[model samples]
Target: MADKEATVYIIDLGHSMGEKHSGRKESNLDFSMRYVWDKISTTVAASRKTWTIGVIGLRTDETNNTLDENGLEGYENISVLQEIGPMSMSALRELRSEIKVSKTKQGDAISAIVLASSMIEDFTKKLKYNRKIILVTDGKGAMDADSLDEVTEKLNDVGIELIVIGVDFDDPDYGFKEEDKPKLKKKNEEILSRLVSQCKKGVYGTMAQAVEELSVPRIKPVRPFKSYDGPLTLGDPETYPNAMSIAVERYFKTKLAHPPSASTVVVNNAPSRSQVDDGDEAIEDNGNGLGAVRQVRAYKVNDPDAPGGKRDVDFDSLERGYEYGRTVVPISDMDESITNLQTKKSFTILGFIPFSSYEPHLSMGEAGVIVAQKFNEKAELALSSLVNALYELQSYAVARYVNKDNQKPFLHLLIPDPKLESEADCLFDVPLPFAEDIRSYQFPPLDKVVTVEGTVLRTHRLLPTPDLSKAMSDLVDAMDLSKFGKDDDGNPTEYAPIDETYNPTIHRINQAIRHRAVHPEEPLQPPAEILLRFSKPPDELVDQVKKQIDILIKKADVKKVPPKVKGKRKRETVKPISGLDVDALLGQAKRTKIDPENAIPEFKQTLGAATEVKAIEEATKQMGDIVCTLIRESFADINYDRAAAHLGVMREELIALEEPDLYNNFLRDLKKKIYQKELDGDRMDMWRGKIIAGGLGLITDQELEVSSITEAEAKKFEK
Candidate 1:
């Protein structure tokens, strides 16, 4: 089950928010919106039905919230931008239009908070949810301080997490302070900050902190899913009196995440005359009139008695088959049951092994957590004792686990994790790989070279010199991230923390998706600066290891490779790296004759040695004649292979020389002669087998556009 959340984002749109501060180009409202947009975009990307969001516009021109509609006082200039519901791209587009600088600044921030709390309470009613309220403002507007205590109590009573983010606010912990002397703004900031501090669960920070932290990817909070919740046993209770049974629950510790995939869409054709009167669209447009395409699959099998030598079968008629080597092995229901391992859901302690005996590489799957079953005090005490004993003895428990009935069992390595602060003790478990699953692939030794004569030599080019090896080691040490950053108290810390590093692929894709949804006509923006910030080493670190890098480069004798030319055939042919004009030199000879016995090699030499157009035409014409002669004079099917070999050589040479017309034009004329029985007496079998089967037909545009074969002509010639 997915978790339910109702979060309301209150953004101040007062007239003062339109002014720039601290020489920044963007307005204060836009600066504050950076945090708001990111939070909303994340929820939209999740696409979870239960993750609902609401938006409120503070200090707006008009009053339109639940309070203002009910004729409540002090709710003026505050409007509900959106209701609590699952967010979508359409909702984001609507919100973008609504969040702009307002003409008035009469609304009170505390009053807006009260109305937001009322909205969540009324919508959620008595249902349990992860309720939250986020407010981003510049603290430039007036805020009523009366009933502040009561509002805090109401937020805590309903379990709403209040996060207040002020623009240009002071926070000693964050080391930020706005250099100003406005008493009214200072008072508003203090009031909002106090409201957050008084709440039961919340965070109070500056907008700068929130915006700066947005680069780090947000980890989605998932509802704990119990894989199993039953008594874990050692030995059967009926078989041994000393058998053990403890109520334990297993939950996934980590799960894989994937970005949303796009469905294919097709254009909608015009409707018929009868359906033209209706205004209904064929399907939903993706910003264009293109609608999602429907997929139709037909299963068929070869049937000599059926039409077209094939018959279609319903999907239900298909049977599942398992692949055994190269063949599919199908089994009946009874046989499948016999083949499957019939085991009940169980987690049993198979045995214990020393922690040193376990290898981390042996863990194959995602880790799972096992804790004592809820409300079972005795089970908790027993599991805690087991965890303590395992920790003290430096041992791990190997358990046989079957997550469900009739499922295959797997071995799990259970490592104890004990907390000294009186937290519940639990075991971290990883499924172990079977011996058959491990692959022992062999690779040639990198430190030494073994000659084909079975002699080993260590001082070869494959082996790195001692100087190069030491230089590489020194470079690695110089670029170490450990102790690269200063902590809050000015202590050394890791530069790229694990919690801060994000998956660039996931976030970059999501950013592009959201951008396209909002602005279909515009090109996608570049990747966010934060996503690419950690891709390279720190510049200072690179500068420090300049000497080491230079030494390593010299030792390895590395040289820059030339850039590859794109679309060589689209323009003109690229020159060879040897800088020699082989074609021009070869064309100077103007060779014509090609030996029929040595047709392939001799034909290649004629093409490679030719430096003129007439020489190429002569050689190609002679080769075409040789191919037809081989097929025409063959004793039945004896010379078919020889003819096919000659055709293959002609095709390869034309493609290399970017002269597709030379091969395609000749092949087409040859195909016509064979099909029309002009080459030999009824040699269609050779045409079908060697010409069609070997794919030695015409050269399409895929080979090169220099060919004379039209799209229709290419298809007709293939048949």
Candidate 2:
């Protein structure tokens, strides 16, 4: 790949080459010619074999003159300066100098590419690899859909990398005209994006600056054999050999070690042999640490014919002398009686009792005494029960279970002592010693009640205390009496006149009084002293003084005038001299002169010199005018529409190659005529009109015309 050769073909398709931009002597084509020439020359000089170069010009079909053998072709391919070797600077310069600025009729960019592809086809076929065709255009293509696709496919098949360098395609102000807008112009952006995607080496640029940016070389990473030992790693770990083995070895070799300890010992004691009985029962000591014990009790296994009658070794028989011990004691009658007593009645020896008449208590008298002795205690207990019941009621309300058919709030009454229960029963009306007083309470209606624990009668019997009349009367009396004051019509009036004593000062009062009073009829006046000090001068007095001065000046002028005199003499007329002819006098001088032949020659020479001098001066003056006109035109905003119309006229003049040399010379001469400073305004306009008409194929031998041309001529002019 590194040894392969790369060829880049650059084509310029800007409409400025069509001779219609900025009204300047140098068209965009001219600039492109110089620009690409320099670029190719430089690239060739730097790396000749590695790079190949090509160039093409693009314009609309209306202005281009060069054509293919097939008449009225849309595109023209200019010859490229081929094989510009690294050492051939002179050849490059020669090629650059040979570049001619010609107009193209078909500025459509598609035609430009087709022409460029045709021209570079030979060069592309010869190259084995890395072939590239870079288009440097102002984004104007006009080939038909079929031809465009064909040309594009051809370029792609040849493995030619197409790089488009779009230069100011959207800038109509630069060179492009509005009328030249392509039918497929809207797809230009999408086409450029697709081209870049397909070409792999293609790029779009809006300016020379963007072109420079695209030309910058990209930097590639250098693949290294070893990875760096740092916080950030960017190499593949798999490339390193025995990495896991090295890690395991490093781990085991660097670990610490320790030793083990000894075991513990325990002692056992047994009864002596002398303590065993003689014949009553033999004793034995087990070596496995069982103490010496007499076998006074022994049970035999089941034997069918054994002593006393087939004794079966029953598990029940093993307890003949030994009684089975129970961990828990059995209940005696007295204990059972006590348990029954404990179960039948609950003790109040230790439990919470409310100290309030409203809450559960020992007795009403006791509750009353507690409430009197400890008001906060009774109140706290009562409030806690009320709040707890209310909380439960709220829960029932939220659950929507209150006052439901089966769901009812229950009240539990506890009477640890019969005396307390009897007292509770006497206060209430239930059958139990302790009765629920809810019978007297009137509960809220079924729907309204969140939880009904008692009868509705209790709720009705309980009434809220009536408010104190004296307190209500005092509150009413405390309100301001002025707020209730009314007018005679019985309508309430505003509160008593806001204390005027605390109102504004006397100066404010005066201001208010003045604001209410009607405006005076007389004109407002400043103080008399102020008027005297600042009055304007009197107009009548000043006018009177000025009039008197005018009269005095008139009188002085009348006195200074002098009297005029009248008298004159008439002059006589002179007669004409017929003998003294102007030509004869000049000729006699010439005849009487010594050395007449030399004099004649000198006179003729002098006359010729004078005539030449006058002519030169006139020419210089005309050149100065041309220079000024050109300067003004260059700086002036170009009328692109007019210039484009004139370009159409220019395309008509250059028709066939019958006088190819003459046509070329005429074009060169036309360029010089338009560019020269000596051309007058009318003469320049005439020459410019001729050039435009010639280029547009609108000109004829009968004095170059500016009118429209036939379609055939227009098509020919387009090429």
Candidate 3:
């Protein structure tokens, strides 16, 4: 299991591959390609540079391999579809198109294997790479058995693994045996079996079995990387007399993994001439060219002397700068180096504190394990003593860690975890936040309200009452999940175990990608039940808390607010319970004017007294005249607010009466007269500040039903 791999697939592309085999609707070539596509797609999804792939088509119509091109014999009808290199989406497209049935079914599988071996060996001569050769065939074409021994020895010497897959081949173990198979096909299968058997590392199996196992999910093995490895020192070893050091190594205990991010692509309608364009004839056009889009950036600054009032600058001409208060301080590369804090690689302990004094919430980032040096008995004993002593005292150590020379220093907390019986004598370390990383935000007190006079009240509306508190506590108690589920023996246990709850975001994305790769045509299935197991509360738990929830809602006085109606507004006025005539009786002697001294109340009473649209219209005219007179006779800005308030009331009353045209027309005339200085010498302040700012300019169709006013016309009128 090496990190670097060089796997080449020798796919059979003979004429017979285009034909169907035993009860399968798809051709043999398409059926076998399911496995190849899945494997290659997985490698592409990983996006690793070390995982490379090569494809060699066997039993092709032409000869275009290294062996045949070099004038060597017995290597015809074989082509090198793709060179061994870093596999990407572009290379995958080329390999897929290169795999097609040939007109002539005359080629040797053994020769194709040799060709693949030479390509792999030439590319990875003495380097450390996991070399593998996979040959897929229906065994219908010829396979020379003369150089079997030599090829087997060469593969073993080169340390290459061989795998041969036969489509519709006999396999007693798989409960499949093709009846009445051709003589040549049987002989070729036997030859392939022997070739795999003689090799040191090989696997000979039927293609059906391999394709069936493609749906099973596999876990990728990761190589362990050390985050830090140095001495754990208490006090400066060179400065203190009681200083001590323990040789130790550190490895990740909880490493983070990220899901694959989606890339932006654009479908090109024509051939692209850009250098980074990915569309070519090798990829299927599907009636439209598809290419990955690339992002470009530019920098510009405003310049009065330049054309278009802007000047473009090259990115290389710019220097990095940081903000200092209200100004930016530019620092050159040389100046930055002088200001940077540099340190050497070391792990030194600062001091120890009681476990009670150290807060668990302060520890952040990935956790790691600090262990004694490997195969060093003295270091192991010394570290073990430290672990046990810290464990007994219930204390933790604070340490300063520098990963490498010139690297930034970080604070870490190391907690003792000693269980020698299970060989777990180690200290777990987690990164600690600096003072700059800690955030302190002040929030208002939840239990009491403080008045402006420094009086503290605990019985305010924001505070919960005794019955409300009790009801909440009862609801919380009923929703407890501990010991809620039954175990195998029918005993109560924890409802949701930590190990059984899978991360929905991580697993769901992976499942979708895998399904798409295997079944390109079928719709995606629902997420597995295990992934959604802990998404919601159990039915039994919800049923038991129904009554408690109702009690809590009643005690808290919880009520749902009515939804706000948008677009259209309707005014609802309730009719009197008893037959009465209040506004109608007052309107019998309709007051024709609004008093200037008490205009607001008198104007409101006039409108309230109106019983018909004609009376409402007449009242609006009187108020409008009074508002104009107030602005005309005001001493300065004294009556600006009063005029605005009167206009606001008129606007609301007319809108309620479904006669917005009256207010709109009056406002228009007032704006025109005030701007022209026809009312007095200058009244622009009242017109701009009151009419414009107070939103008393116009009434549109949105607020009134009968009157019509376009939004654009209203804006023009206000302006």
Candidate 4:
């Protein structure tokens, strides 16, 4: 069922609105009217058949067009342009024609509020709709506080929300003189603030903030995650009894109330510097001639007159024991008992169907509408799982409430992303708005279904379902991963590449459904196949290269020689005793200790150096081979960032070994291999920049002088 709502726009047409407001292209009246129209349009589109919009101009020069609603008459400046009605293109066009700047005096703001509230109340009297009155005005109008209070009481009694968007002042961007702001009536300003506050159902802000807010669809608070344990059956129970006892979870289309916080504050703990003089009093001198002396109090524990004087005790005779002071009591104690709150209901998954088959049902009945996935994590997972599962079983559960008020049914799409199921306690999480809350969610009639190779399609809407299953299979098969990113503990970590735009599974099903509904007349076409193309490197790949180059340049900038290890010195020998005084020196012999620090082990430099050098060369050779393989594989499915990062580490190691020639040669060869691959001009430029940046230190005057040697000559005239 559609969410019913009524929004009545009360636009100010006072002569003051004709004045220019900063940051707006049109006059204040014109801008406010347009903003109101946009808000109405957005509300209508989002709410569909359930929303209605009305327009009421605050001040109108034409006395004949004045409104006489709710028994009040002679409101010469007020005009009822359009009454509340369902939104349509014609209605919006009519509203645009009616809104204009008033050439007469301003209308009574209190009267305008009373009239708008009455109109909204009348329109939403029979229907269960949310009543709202959006007032757009400048603060220079006149109103009595008593009248405002009366209207506020009426609006509150009718449960009508009043949102006041005042074009109170010129925007900072507009170069308006200080004198241009009109002197607003103090009583009118106070009344407007009081009216909005007393109602306690609306918000107040500038037109700019209000206009920005209307651009996006308003959403409710996030429903909590839920899970169920039961058997899920699919198809007709009498004919085909296909069922599974799978642990199921439901996710709602919702988002967190607040954004992930990245705000931080840094504290400066350095002591402040101040001048002090050697005296009992401190002298404070200003730039002026006069100086003031401030008395400084000092305390000495050793003085007998001091509050905490030194204690007298016999230290030698006292027993060694610790002193205990008074025990401190806490202000509050926490209840440590664990409370287990059951926030989910157990429901059986009744049936399952292919997402392609489910697409048409999303746009079919007036009673059932599409429910969009809220968070990106759930959306991305659902699309991926559905597309991939289409290759195998190609079915998702359709759940019904075991204990609910309405007991209505809705499609239950499963998003079996591995990250969601990594938790040990549960299979996955489900979100709320369960069967009790949902009403009239009916699937499309099965008899009218048309199947193209067993995949269901609605006969009324002739559309082709894309072969997502085939595409997903090919994508999985194309992955030839040599390695994955790992943490310091050597555990492989999840790597979500930045270039997710190319992935066909990102919100695939939902986007398709929305597109179909928006253009119901047009036949659905298959989405373009996501072929593994490598003509141009993705933006992320280029960014990765630049980041790697930056790191390498920084490393080369802070290059330092390894600290030298000093060998131990030779040990000195003890003088030999002339005579073996057997009995006398036997005890001294036992007490004598060896000088372990001075006893140095024999050092062999040449052999150790050769062995270390050989090991370095072998490791470098292996890494070089891996780098070359990855460079070639980059044309396929290999991650360019990982390859570049490995190459950067290899370059650093080679530089540490003082193998400048080898490092330069490796870069030159790597460049050739990259160029040989299917790289476009942009990719070629990125590679060139990376090479120049990373190999800046490795360049020598000799290499520069011999740079004239062409690639052909170097290969052909090899010695």
Candidate 5:
């Protein structure tokens, strides 16, 4: 089925439906029913094609009146309405009358969905087109969170668009208090938005709005043919105007005459009289005729590899003379050794390169040079490799087409990696000019083209002496160049790999560094530490060491410091140390205590409260410096210039310190969080699948029944 068609299902009826508005005479349910019925009927009548419309109504429980002989229940108590066409307003009226309002339960909305889904299942199977289910209701949804999620998921799975229409949520008359109406409407909007986001093309709106939107049908655009202004001649006549015709004729004759076991003849023969005269006469007969013909001279088509080819062909102009019986020289007779031997023909060499391997930055000229080198050095080996690579790429293209059930001919190219530019250049010195032609070629639409990126090189051609010219020729000749029919969308279908963008080595190195920083490992610890330690010196080294020893002793001390309680009454005030005085004392102490023997005891004695505080401040500052160094070194390793930007030192310093059992707790918490996330994702996926399956009618209530969780189900799956 075409993707454009839409199957719209309009659902109506609910419990609070019957409740009358505070100011209005009509009930919410009555307004919704009439609004939806009128809108759907109008939309159906306006549609160009017969739109399959399924009408269902919702209430709390299933009714015998609604159930058919097949045990399938319709919308509300009436099950589903009978057939209704776009112009069938009476049928819609009849359906409205049949819908009986029942008690609204929490599961009513979900049950209604399940019932509608059942009806849709049958319809979708018969109609493989676009399916849309529009559920028209008031702001109130009776279904619980789990059931709603399940129903929405099912709808999505079946490729059904679920559109919800909430009527009169803002109407104070419909039992919605003026003060709470806005909040209720906002809540409904949020719920609808969340549901729509989960389902493709799903949306919610008022009945009036939805009808207006769905009424507009989409149209497909028409593509016009583009004209080519170049010469319409089949081949280079001056050289081998009739070369292609003769070759084609000979190829057919050989196949017919020889039947099965004939050697494939490489067409090297010059143009015959019959071939050229017939072609010229045919061209002249066309309305846009070639004027008075002059003496036809073969022009030299230069072969880059063969420098010695005679560059000209000669012929009599038709206007000048009706010359006949022109002598022909066979291609085999020409001195094959002469590099400049003129030929009467040209052919297009269509090659395929894997888009993954193609390096867009490498120019055609560069590729030509590489090809030439490879051919010159390793003739047979280079040719074989090129053939194999081309073949593999072609196979992939073919497989892709086949998977899509398309039987069209395609050419897929596996481009060479830019990293292999030097090697490729060395291998194929003279780049085939065709590579440039392809690079400049504009591609078709995305739907018509498929490109696979980031493919790793598996095997390459091994060569002894590469002959660039012969290799290029062999590669060109090996390809099967043939035209095929167009696709359904009227696009010329050919499977060609896209050119791969080149990534600079510097960028790659930077990426590696960034990745390492984010995911540091134990193996990197030593280097990381070295980098940190070398970046800065420990402040007040001697004092810090002495303080460390003293602090450890103090921590070990079971007795507390003397308290100044003074019978809880008389409090003694102590003078604070000034920054200037402390600095002076430290300066004097540093000058006086030069020797370790002198400094050690004095440092210990001076390591009062002041020394301890100083040690902590210095340690924290040093740690910050260390973290910054690690960050800088990381950037440097990747050749990135480190700007003098401040690292959030406080955060890093806090992380660096080994907390009391906090790291262990953090690890446990992290593991739990990861596990929970994974568990949640799996559950979501499962629910999503179930929703789709249910919507498609692939699963029923019996099939969807959840069994008790077993030990196997509880265990996490291994990666």
Candidate 6:
């Protein structure tokens, strides 16, 4: 079962909602709140008494003292109808009688959202629960997009999901006149869209969808603990009179929380079979004319890990016990059901396989392959943490069938596989799962899993694929060709470890061959089968990249040469003036004289002369380092705006140093590094924009290509 949940329903009660819509007898306000009540009741039932519901009214009647006694001014006509509480059948039944339509105009949607969020926050304070808000409106109220955006952010910050259900958006056959129907203005739609998008967990739909889906509980997939069921045989056919078969089930021993239970009551008036001891029994007289005695069922309570906690022992059945004179007691029906929550089992290992090898059998196909690969890249740190855990434990893994179906197996490493040396006439085999057999899988909880840092694993979403359409088309064509088959080099299509452990047969054959080398008297081993290896990238693609890199390098070399002076000017030297008498000259020299040229302040020296070549080089190197650091940091943080702004600033600073050519060279170099680093389309586009927006100083206005993938390069790949 899911954790406890809280949902706040913000219903619109404006004059418009009083009119009938979709030819329904109930007013729109009534219909929307009824739908909200249904959702609350359904969620509570589905969650097994774990959900709470709160109701708020938008554009509520200001004069109604029962609903708005506090009369919070500046709240924009929003009023609390029902405080948040656990939903019950009685509460849902009484919801319709409590809500009433208002004559006032619809309240500002943004204000209502803000007010409802505060109510949700106070209710969920110190409580561990999933928070949600359902906004029911006709999408008619005017709202500031910016305010709505802020509300969305705040809700997202507090981990609240906002679901907006717009009524009468598409329905035209309503009881209201055609002119009276809400048009769903573009501005309102846009504001709602932005709100939903920014909320992260937010959802938006029409009234029809809400009616159909709101009552249905959302079922999310959960990871299941797996155990294997197989037959174990013993005794050799020649030595033993008969072979015996034993059933073996393999699973991890897991501690699970006990489900909550309710009290059982027995009345003297009713016939009942009770297990309560006389000493343990407590009786109370009912306040009735008959004065009947009622007995409450007694239960044992203890900490989750306490050994004396309630055990599942059936009083109705018995079996043989380990002791000669003892009998095995059957667990009570109640205890049996609770005991089934926990599990324990055993397994025998076959061999080990890589995660890449295991991924294909997971049933996602081509798209899954790409997603898994991206996940491997994005979640590398988390995977490394898990790998480090194995190193700490000094553990090795082996493949084993995990469940009864036995169609798929996982890498079981924490627990070592049981040895089969004692058993005879036994066969061990691992069957790889076919694509159709692969079901969705979830990782075990962080506490149960062994990881170095206990870092939580994050599942990344599918990234934008701007060029996927073309790539997919090309893939379809390649697959259609009958001649496009296996590689001539006898390589595996997918990555696989080329080691002795990967193939037992190859290891045995090699061992035999080595033995024959030591003892020539023994028969020589047969030739070994060829091992599959990974094929190298096609020469066409490799050469294309190399050519592009070479072109870039040559271009950089050309830009490095300093421009020659057009014409050398002849230098003219002036002779010094004659000196005066020693005494007069000494007096004049002692006097403080400030020339106008000397009084004028001197700015920092610019990089111009050949003598300042070393200085220029140092300055350029420092500036390049700073720029590269900024660019790298911005790209790493995915701050494209910051990166663009920094790039523009660097351009102006570089131009000030009088090294425009050098700056241009740096741009080309940065572009090359970005290309080599494999920045995706979005990053590349931002970099390109930054270079262009910086104007003619930073980069040439000549429209130089920056992505490194020229038209020619793309065409070469097409071939």
lDDT scores of the candidates, listed in order: 0.83, 0.38, 0.83, 0.52, 0.39, 0.51
Tens-digit lDDT string for candidate 2 (639-674): 323433333322221221111222333334444655
- Best candidate (score: TM-score): 1
Global local distance difference test of model 5: 0.39
State, as a TM-score between 0 and 1, how close model 4 is to the true structure: 0.37
**Tens-place lDDT digits, model 4, residues 524-639:** 54553332233344455455456444444453354667653222112222335775555356664321221222211101111122235555454555555655555555554344
TM-score of candidate 2 versus the correct structure, residues matched by position: 0.25
- The TM-score-based order of candidates, best leading, equals 1, 3, 4, 6, 5, 2
What's the lDDT of the predicted structure labeled candidate 4? 0.52
lDDT of 5 by residue, 297-379 (tens): 34455566555954443443111222356844343323433534333222222333454554545433321111222124444
Colliding pairs, model 4? 226-430, 250-430, 250-431
RMSD of 1: 8.0
Instruction: Say which prediction, candidate 1 or candidate 4, comes out ahead on TM-score.
Output: 1
Q: How much is 7 displaced in model 1, in angstroms?
A: 2.7
How many residue pairs collide in each prediction? 5, 47, 0, 3, 65, 8
TM-score of predicted structure 1: 0.72
Q: List candidate 2 segments past 4 Å from native.
A: 6-10, 13-15, 18-27, 30-38, 59-87, 118-121, 124-127, 170-201, 211-719
Candidate 6, residues 533-565: lDDT per residue as tens digits?
123443544554564444445533435566633
User: Model 3: runs farther than 4 Å from truth?
Assistant: 19-25, 44-50, 63-77, 103-111, 138-154, 165-199, 204-218, 260-344, 353-364, 373-381, 392-394, 417-425, 433-719
- Model 2 has an lDDT value of 0.38
Q: In model 3, what lDDT does residue 448 have?
A: 87
Candidate 6 off by > 4 Å: 47-50, 62-72, 125-129, 140-146, 170-190, 214-719
